[model samples]
Target: MTTMTDTSPREFKMPDVGEGLTEAEILKWYVQPGDTVTDGQVVCEVETAKAAVELPIPYDGVVRALHFPEGTTVDVGTSIIAVDVASGAAPAPASEAASASASAEKAAPATPAAPAAKPAPAAKKIEGRKPVLVGYGVAESSTKRRPRKGVPATAAPAEDTLYAAAAIQAVQGELNGHGHAPGGQRPLAKPPVRKLAKDLGVDLATITPSGPDGVITREDVHAAVAPPKAPEPVVEAPSAPAAPAVAPAPVASYDGARETRIPVKGVRKATAAAMVGSAFTAPHVTEFVTVDVTRTMKLVEELKQDRELAGLRVNPLLLIAKALLVAIKRHPDINASWDEAAQEIVVKHYVNLGIAAATPRGLIVPNIKDAHAKTLPQLAESLGELVSTAKEGRTSPAAMQGGTVTITNVGVFGIDTGTPILNPGESAILAVGSIKLQPWVHKGKVKARQVTTLALSFDHRLVDGELGSKVLADVAAILEQPKRLITWA
Candidate 1:
C-alpha cells in the first residue's frame, strides 16, 4: 500500500507512436489496477492505422487504474492509465485494487476546505512528474471552456481571473472516472466522450457521471444528450373496422455457420483500395510466356553449393528476381511511375523491388531498397530478411512505402500465373507460376525440361504492347539460357 498520507496518483497519457496518427484502438492491456509496473515496461498493445505497436509506461509505480479499457479508440496524448508512486508503493498487487480506490476516495476532499486549495486538475499537477517528459503531460486542448453557471451574466474576465488565482492551490487526489461530483471538481471524460458532448451541446458539468469513481462515460454523455422517448399519446377510435392482416412473406435463410464475416481493415483494407484504384484507373495489359528453365534450375542447385552463396537463400525466386532486374536494366521504361497531376511518365533511376508477402494479417508488399545495385548474394540476404520479418508481423511501415515494381510468386500456393494488379504508383508487376517438368525440344530433340508460365501485367497507358512483350521475353530468355545473365547483365 502507498503511504497513507500521500494518496495522489500520476497519470500516463498516450503518446503519438506514429507520424501524426490521431488515434489508435487499444488491443490489449498487460497490467490491471493495483498491479505493479516498472519504467519502460510494456503496459498495452495498440493497433494504429499504420501498424500495431506496444506502448511502454515511463515510470515505476503501482498501477492505480486503467482509464480506457481494451478496444477503446483512445486519442493521442489522452491519459490511458494512472499510477500511484507514493514512497514504498512500487509493487502494489492486483488484490489491493479495491482497497486502493477506497483509500483514494477517502483522501479526496468534498470541497476546497482551505482557501488555498484550487486550480484546474491536470496530470501534470503532480509534483513527482516534473522529471518526466512533457509528451505524457495533460494534453492541451483547443476547446474553450463553457462559462461557469454561477458566474454573473456579464464577462468579468479580469475580476474572475484575479479571484481564482488568489484561491488556487492545485487539489491533489486520484481522479474518479465517474463524473458525478461537486461543481468544484471538473468532469472527467475520454476524448470521444468529450467530442460527443460537444457535438450534442450537452454540458458535461451538468450531467451526473455514471462511470467508475467519478469519470464521465460515453453512455452518461449520451443519456444526457438523449433521454428515453415519451410514449405516443393513446387515441381510442370508436367502432373502427379492422382489416384482415396480410400474410408475412417467407423469410430468406442461409447457413450462418458455413459463412464467415471478417472485417476488412489494416493491410487488407489498404490493399483493396490500391487494387481497386489500379484496376480501374490504369488499364492493365498482361502477357503470358511459358519458358523452358531446365538450365536455370540446374544453376540454382550449383550456386547453392558455391562457397560465395553457401549461406544465402538460393532458389528459383532468387534467379527470377535477378532476371527481372536485368530485364528492367535493359528496359528502364518499364520501371517507372505515372504522375497524373504532372501529366508525365516519371522514370525511376533506382528500383525498390517489392516482393509480395502473405502473412496471417493480410497480403503485404515490402520492398527491398535499392535492389538494382545489390549483387546476387546481397539480394538473397535482403529477400530472406524481408520474408522472415513479414512472417513475424514485425515489418515496419517504411519497408512497404516506396516501390517501383513488384513480384508475386503464386507458385508457392501451387497455382499457375495470374494477372496481378500493378501496385499503385508502379507501372508493372511480374507473376511467377508453379514450375513443373514438361516435354520440350532441346537441340532438336524432344525431352522433359523445367517449365513455368510467366505473366507480366503493365499499365497500358505507359507501356505499349511492343515494350511489354520485350520485357517479358527478356526475362524468359535469361531463365532459359542461365548463361545469358553474364552476357546481358
Candidate 2:
C-alpha cells in the first residue's frame, strides 16, 4: 500500500488479477480523468493470458489519470491509475497529469542505486501501519526510522537512509506478494518467475533482484541462467581488402492493401504455446474408429422428449461424453496423467471433463468438475453452462484448470475427423467427427446408418497401443448399441 497525503494522488497499481499472471493488456477503461469513482467500483477491464478480468478501485476518489491507454500491456505492481483521495476535489486535467508524471520521472536519479529514494519518504510514513486489505492499508502508527544495515544511524548518507526506509516498506508489502523478502527470508518472486527459475535450474536466492523492493523478477531469473559471454577479441584488419559482405536475402514483402496481420496475444498466445508444448512433450498416438451412431442419435431424440431430461441439451456429444466416462470407469487407467517430474503415471479417481469451445477471443477448454459423478441431466446442464460462459468470455481461470480428459466436437464444423493434440497435462482427448448418413453393415445386410468417426489421442508414454485401442473400442461399442450405456455403465 502507498501512503497518501491530503493532496497527493493515491496511485493504484495493476494487480495480479489471475494468480501468477505477470501482466495484462488494458481492454477498456470504465472511468476517465476527473471522473468520480466509489470504493469497490470497477475502473478498468484487463485481458490477462488466462481471461478478461475487471479491476476495482480500493479507495473512493476522482480519477486523476490513467497511466496507460487501452491496448497497452502493463506489468503487475506497476501503477496504472492515480486517484485524488481528498474529499470533493476534482482531478487535474489529463495534460497536467501527464506533464506532472513526466516531470517526476525526469527528476529521479539516473543511477539505479537510489531510484527508490524518490518514493521512500511517502512510503516510510506508513511503515508501521497494519494492512487493511490485500494491497491497501491504513495509517495507524508513526514509527521512528530504522537504521540501514552496515550503516550507523547517525553516519549513513541521507539518500542511503531514505533508500533503506523505502526498501523496508516494500519488503513488508512483499509478504503479500508485491515486493522482496528481507534478509534470511525466502526470495521474493512472482509464481511465474519461480516456475521459470525451476525450469532453467536456477536458484532464486543466487540471483540479485533488480525489481522494486528487492523482488526477483523474470529477467533476474533468466539472467542467472544465461551464461556469461567472453570479451570479444579485437583483430587488426588485414592489409588485403575485406571480402564483400553477402547481401542479405531480400526481405519478404507483402502488399499492404491486400494483406492483414493480427498480433497474437492474450488467450490466443497462451493457447498456441500450450499446444506446441503438449505436442512435443507428449508422444501422441491417435487411434481412429468409425462407428454407426444411428442408435445413439435415436436415443438423444428420445431423451429430449423425456420429462427428466426436459430443458437439457440432449445431444450426441452428451452421450459420447457419458460413454467415455463409463469406459474410464471400466478401464480406470485411461483417465490418468503422465507425471514426468515424478517419473510415474498418476491415475485419477475423479474426472474433470473438459469441453473445447471456440469463442470470439480464441479456443478455451473449460471443464466440469467431478463430471464422472454427475447424472446425465446434470452433465448436460454443466455442459450448457460451460458453453454459454465461454461464448460470453466469462470463463474463469479455475474453470480451465485440472482437466483430466477433453472432448472436442469437430462434428459441428462439418469435419469428418481430426487428430486433436492432447490438452497439456491431460492424458487423452477425444475428437468427435461429423455424424452423417452412410452405408454400413447392419444385421446381415448393408443399410444406410448414421455414422461418425471418433479419434482418441493419448500420450504414448503412459497409454500403450493396447490401452488406447480398448478405450476407443468401448466408446464405439456404446455408440453403436446405445443400450450398452445402461448395461455397461
Model 2 Cα lDDT, one tens digit per residue, 132-225? 2223344332123443443222221332232233323332222222222456344556434554665576766677889886677778988877
Error of 2 at 264 (Å): 0.7
lDDT of 1 by residue, 1-489 (tens): 244544678776776555555777776676789888654345675665555655656446788889998768888878898988655433222223334444545676452232122223222233222211111332233012232443221211222232122111111112112222374444665433554665577777788877675567778878876756642222223443333233356665544366667766555666788899999999999999999999999999999998988777889999999999999999999999889999999999999999999875678898999999999999999999889777655566667878999999999999878989999999999999999988999899999999999999999999999999999999999999989899999
- Which stretches of candidate 2 lie above 4 Å from their native place? 1-6, 87-256
- TM-score of the candidate numbered 2? 0.65
Task: Name the candidate that leads on TM-score.
Answer: 2
Model 1 / residue 306 / CA error / Å: 0.6
Scored by CA lDDT, what does every candidate get?
0.70, 0.73
Task: For candidate 2, give the lDDT of residue 418.
Answer: 96
TM-score of 1: 0.61
Clashing pairs in 2: 174-179
